[model samples]
Target: MTHAHFAPGRRTFLASMGAAAALLPFAGAGRAEGTSTTRRYVGLYFNGAWDVLLGPDPRDPAQSYDGIDLGTDALAAAYRDPIPVMMAGQEVLWGPTMASLAPHADVLTLFRGVNMNTVAHPAGRAYVNTFIPPSGVVPKGDSMGTRMAAAGAYGDLILPNVSIGMPTFNLVFPPDVTGVRLDRATEMTDLLEPLGDMPLSEATLAALRMAQDEVEGCVHEQYGRPPVEDLQIARDRMRQLLSNGYGESFDLAADADLKARYGITNPGASNDPAVIAATVWRLLETGLSRTITAQLQTGLDTHGPEWATQQPQRQQAGFDALAALLTDLRQDDPNLDDTTVVVFSEFARTPKINGRGGRDHHFAGSVLVFGGGLRRGVCGATLEQTLGLAAIDVATGQPDPAGRVLLPEDIGATLAHAAGLSHDPFRTDPLLDWIA
Candidate 1:
């Protein structure tokens, strides 16, 4: 489905990257009614096509395959090897890089054979995030983060949706729900902190508020337009932000234990995997945002000899950071009890090793959805030899001839359903069996 462009008359203020983290205030008449879920969402995007053989859809190195490269023949590395792990009585092979995450096998669920439908980087990323097959290179729908905000899941949160080094699109969702972009997690402090100390005294502050209210009254009397209303909303929200002392809560570096756990030596200058994950945790723990999408790893598009080395190292580092995030969440505040983390790559690498000793892009993908009330198990699979997608029963997550191939829309719909969105614009239903 396509969303109409933002009307010329509507005034929507988006947060500028590298600038102050300003937010569009909730200008609508409060939030839409009937939001049924309190669960928050975290999206960890592994940019570039990840090699599934080294991640969520690993294959045994000792196995003989007709067309698949187990990476054991010529391209051999400790990280490229797969290790068997049992989850819910099922034996699954996870890349050795998943060692840190394997311990949490009981709380996470794996989805394989996800048909990304596109091998292009931009199109695949857009499709996965927006749940609409891109119209060429453009996204046709709002991101799940924006949709969750529009669904009123964030209530009156000032910064409801946050995108950190991840693409977030908004088509029809309210402008207030647009994801605020940030390069580093510590920038949140910059967004919330006042430019300088409150130079105005209480009397002056009250006077300024009165003057703005008077001007707003005059503007409303002369021009009853949406833009004027939106401006007033922004003003009121900024005032609320300054008065609430929200910036103080986002001082992540001040937390000695958090710094030690995430290895955040300098939060302001660091955008490492640990820092990004820590920022996500802080945002949710402080109730500053409901939905967050962050880029967890990069450089996975290995079509050269480095695939045997760099690919696994990158994947392992990313997984290690994620495992730490989960542990921190569960240990400190039980964030995992009420929060769901969705990890995805645009697509998986080709099954066979190329002439360069690397893998090319493959449309069949895998996903990891865990935390909240999700059951721990594996769903869907790839063909034994070719590594192509296998049709799976959506309910049972098992391969079946009569079942349909899982699409990005199904994942999107499931996220929306879990978030308690009343609408279902996706073409398919959610995987109900995966939910608790």
Candidate 2:
């Protein structure tokens, strides 16, 4: 009998994690259409800085470094005394808050050393999206969205990429070759006024369909068999939708009850990052959107008791919501044994509690990688209580292959890989070497 979390291995075993009530049933396209379609990768790139020590840490102090007393009660209880140095004490690394996501850890791979330098959210956001640090005006360059859009020439009929939430997705590629941008709203009136076209109303719709046929005509010539007319039809309909407008991701209001459960006072209205995350997943499952960018709330730079007591709970809520989403995804598509999900942040909190009772941002951080197909257990070093310059071999932390500290660019690279794109898509900075 499989419980809601489908437990096995080291997933969701920690005591600190919590479970979320299932929100809505999975939405499928149903048994309508055509031939077979192969599975493609779907990814989520969470933007922000999430503290490692506050969550899951997997390093054994005794063998890891000298005079290191820092360790979690979980790690301490699980690993015991004389914990082997550099040895992974657990098969999967997660906090009790993430229990709902544990069952799908097998294909997951966590990169603990996702440290970055920028504490400024905007700059860090740029660095996280594109593998380039924020510079001047354009700050960073080609993010995953642009990379996939350019590669749209390849792949199946579906747009190579699409996004929700983050503006970074909008800036990823050159506009000409970009894939369909699924705005939550579109209107036929919006199209004509912008283009100053003579064609009005129904005429405009007809013209758009004709253009789609032309695009498909060019595409069909490449194949020997009759063109996948079915795909061309889809393209035509999508073009029509674009012309008609107002087809942005599903309306949160339509599901007032579900929206309330998912905690949607409105988009970005709820301070709970979980609600935004759930909305992102809803879009992805419906195929209305391809990728989801989950960003946690700002103002977490807690420098007082308020931080310790308040911030942790917010993160817990975010994690719990994320966990529940994962549980739901699994229940719906256990076949998506390959479904991959990610949680990341700009940088880590300070290694030690500051005089202000709050933790300042730090040079090191970590990542939580789950779902899809892969290996588990800790990949990077878990501070084992000791951190900062005090970390034994900071040069090669357990999370870092050789204790190599990381930058924001590494996260973009890692996300590109996790989403099944080549890390060198844009030949930007090198990606973190976690998966391959």
Best-fitting candidate, scored by lDDT: 1
Regions of model 1 farther than 4 Å from truth: 1-36, 73-77, 151-153, 196-208, 215-233, 243-253, 265-270, 332-337
The Cα local distance difference test for each model comes to 0.72, 0.45
CA-only RMSD, every prediction: 4.9, 13.7
lDDT of 2 by residue, 1-436 (tens): 2112211111211100111111112112221133122222333444445555555443333354442333333232422322111213455435443444555454455666555556676766666555566674244455544443342232332333444344433232323223333222211113223233464678876786577566533323443333434445445434433544333344445666555555556644544555555565654565543444445444555655555555555556666666656655666666454455656666666655567666667656666656433344454454454554222232233543344554445555555454444555345443333433
Report the lDDT tens digits of candidate 1 across residue range 1-436: 4333221111132221101212233322243354344567788988888888888887776778897877765554566467888887888888788888877787778888999998999888888777767887777777766776555455466666788876677655556566777765666676675556657778987897787665533333433433444445556666666678777666766788887887667767544777788888877777777788888888888999998887888888788889888886677436265677889988989988889889999988988987745667888888888889899887888899889888888777776665666335786677778767
Error of 1 at 371 (Å): 3.1
lDDT score of residue 303 within candidate 1: 94
lDDT for position 19 in model 2: 16
Q: Which residue window of length 10 is worst by lDDT in model 1?
A: 14-23
